[model samples]
Target chain A: MEFDKGLIGGSTVLLILSLLEETDRYGYEIIRELESRSDRAFQLKEGTLYPILHKLENDGYVESYKAKGERGRDRKYYKITRNGKRQLAKEKEQWEKFSMSVNKVIGGELYATD
Target chain B: MPLTKVDKFLEDVLSHIKFPFVKDDISFELESHILEKIDYYMEQGYDSEKAEELSIRDMGDAKEIGILLNKQHNPFLGWLLKITNGMMIFFIILNIYFAGIPFISSLFSKNPINTIPKEDIVYKIDINDDKIKKIQITLNNGETFTETEFYEDLFLFAWEVDNEEQGRYFNNIKGYDSNNNVIFQDEY
Candidate 1:
């Protein structure tokens, strides 16, 4: 199922930070990883990703550098910073609380026991 | 060469960006993404044109993307940086012109005192007669000193000279009797 743009937009930074936390990834690699991991459910607009990435860089949440990609082409790779890791943890906690509240309101059984 | 569909798409997107420095990187990254997507589609047996079309479509609206990127690359910040860089270069050149030239020239030139030729001697003073009624001192550089009653008996003469060029002055002194006959002459 395709996710709503508004919903994806709100958590875009969180998703990117989580991805970078695993390892450094370039623009295309990040997009491909997000699509494959979500089983094609999260189809991010290719053009919009850069602005967010650049914003994250500007905010000191991530740092970028140029390196050779698998195709021998120089690519701009982004690495998560310590600040981004802290932000991710905070966002993850918020997400858990938010999803739990959402699930409770929807009468979902996943977090019903808690 | 005619612009390709990909190049046209890039131009459309980049045109909205106000910051020129980041445009090349943005263009390179976006083009690489599109090319990678096209490769993915071609692997699935799609023609090159069809793959390119799909890749461009997946990038979403070019104008919208450009506007978003422009927001991140704030033109004010770019201009500020450009102006600051230009000011820095201007200051460096000004400093070289004002400070560096004299220092470099000094290294190659002779000692400042030696640079003044002997012919440019300014002041030559000579005092031999203790009983003098009149005296006149003249310098080659168009400076003259005259004293009628400089002192009661000592004939004291005092004058200030530039210390940096002191070596060029006080070369000789000639004393004359009341009859204007040379009585004493000495070279310093």
Candidate 2:
């Protein structure tokens, strides 16, 4: 079943940024990476993928450059920036807290810390 | 077909995008994705044709994808472009408003100047009581009536209305009482 897009949409940025932090990757490479890692759960559209890349580039979160690929052809690759790492860390911390709260609520141990 | 799957996909995405400069990047990236997917499917022992078909099918709906892409690409740039378009439209209207009226008004109200000199004029006025204020008059064949300077007793004006030639000239005009009111007007 398709994951609720609303739930997944916000995480896409975090995921892309975190992955790029691992290594510089091309568009298709990132798609393959995300898919394989998520076990085909997050099927991303290429059309949906590009604007995010462009936005990250625009925001200085990531940058793209052309380099010769293994096929001896030029391919565009995106690398995460210092700012992206900072943002990714912030998002991860927020997600951990959010997920912990969600897990507690689901496990019937919903408790609030004052 | 020029309507090849890749071509159609690019058309769908680019149509929603407002920025032209970014089109090349989008085209190259998306085209590369489809090509990569085709390569992957072919690696799994599929024929080239089937690989291409699967790759295209895997891309999902172009319109929906375009909408999502637009949602990301257009926030700042779209609002910026819209404001630019709005300002351009506003300035065009403003230019027409400020510049157009006088030009159009001039076209219709293009009256030939009155060649009559100041010296060769005589207006006889018969009045003794009220002072003359400003006189509004239209010369014979003039397009519009306008105010002329005539402080009575110091200056004089005569309105000559011609029936055959279509009407009025203020050559010799006159008269005012103490309070700049019309004292006498004798039209000849």
Candidate 3:
């Protein structure tokens, strides 16, 4: 199936904010979460992940603070803000409405006589 | 081969990005992330060359991502930066007005200053008061002078005599008694 870059790019922010809402995550961990949650179907590149994370940070939807992990490498971890949580709720509602509408149109074909 | 591929990918991505205020450490972390992704791809049975290309291709547009990252991290910090830059420029101009112009002008001042003149010259005297009395003079190689009453202040009397230039030579001046009292006398 072909992927719509714009749609994917647009949804990426909401998807990230949704994930971050559950808990704070570092860059690598967030990428790992997306892949593992999607069952390896959604493979995010580092470039894609960092930029989205950066944008979310710039938009005031997320914040980052540094912590030194076991490897002694300082990791920048991201957390969702109140605004980000609110944005996620709105996006979730829209997605549900959209999917329900699409399902009605698409799923109805399964029941209809061919 | 993997390292070379990562290097090539880094070069390609770095060329397109303009991280105006981003620190080097952040850039390094980004590189590490890319390298890790490359390693993951390689582990998944992709060859080094293919893995490198695939990783970069999956990364999407660097510029777009960089812009988003900037927004997420700072949130309108660009505007803050612009305002600060304007303030910095204004301060530089203000500094020139306050210090630079005065410093340069003082360098070429018309009244040049030197330290030696202050210490080398001396002698300041003040004459508060002087009085003169009636005077008589006889001219000779040495002058004879007489005064009816002596003045308490002598500097003023000398000044008056000098101004008149009447005595051929000023010397041997004496005070005289006007009635019964000799007020003063001087020889000069």
Instruction: State residue B51's C-alpha deviation in candidate 3, in Å.
Output: 7.2
When sorted by DockQ, best at the front, the candidate numbers are 1, 3, 2
Report every candidate's CA lDDT. Answer: 0.80, 0.71, 0.63
Stronger candidate by TM-score (1 vs 3): 1
User: Model 3, range B1-188, lDDT digits (tens) per residue?
Assistant: 54665555555555544444564545666665666667788999998778877776777666655555554445356558878999999999999999999997776542322322544322112223233344444332454444354223322122123434453444443333444343444444
Best by DockQ: 1
Winner by lDDT between candidate 2 and candidate 1: 1
Which regions in candidate 3 have their CA more than 4 angstroms from the true location? A1-4, A108-114, B1-4, B23-26, B38-188
lDDT of 3: 0.63
Greater-TM-score candidate between 1 and 2: 1
Best by lDDT: 1
The candidate, 1 or 3, that scores higher on DockQ is 1
Candidate 2 local lDDT, A4-101, one digit each (tens): 78777788889999899999999888888889899888887655777788778878999889998887767899999999898899988887787778
Summed backbone clashes in each candidate are 2, 18, 10
> Isolated chain A: TM-score per model?
0.93, 0.89, 0.84
Model 1, span B1-188: residue lDDT tens: 13298898999999999999999999998998888889899999998989999989999899999999999889999899899999999999998998988888667554433445555534434354565555655544445555565432334344556555533244445566677766665554
Q: Model 2, retained fraction of real contacts?
A: 0.53
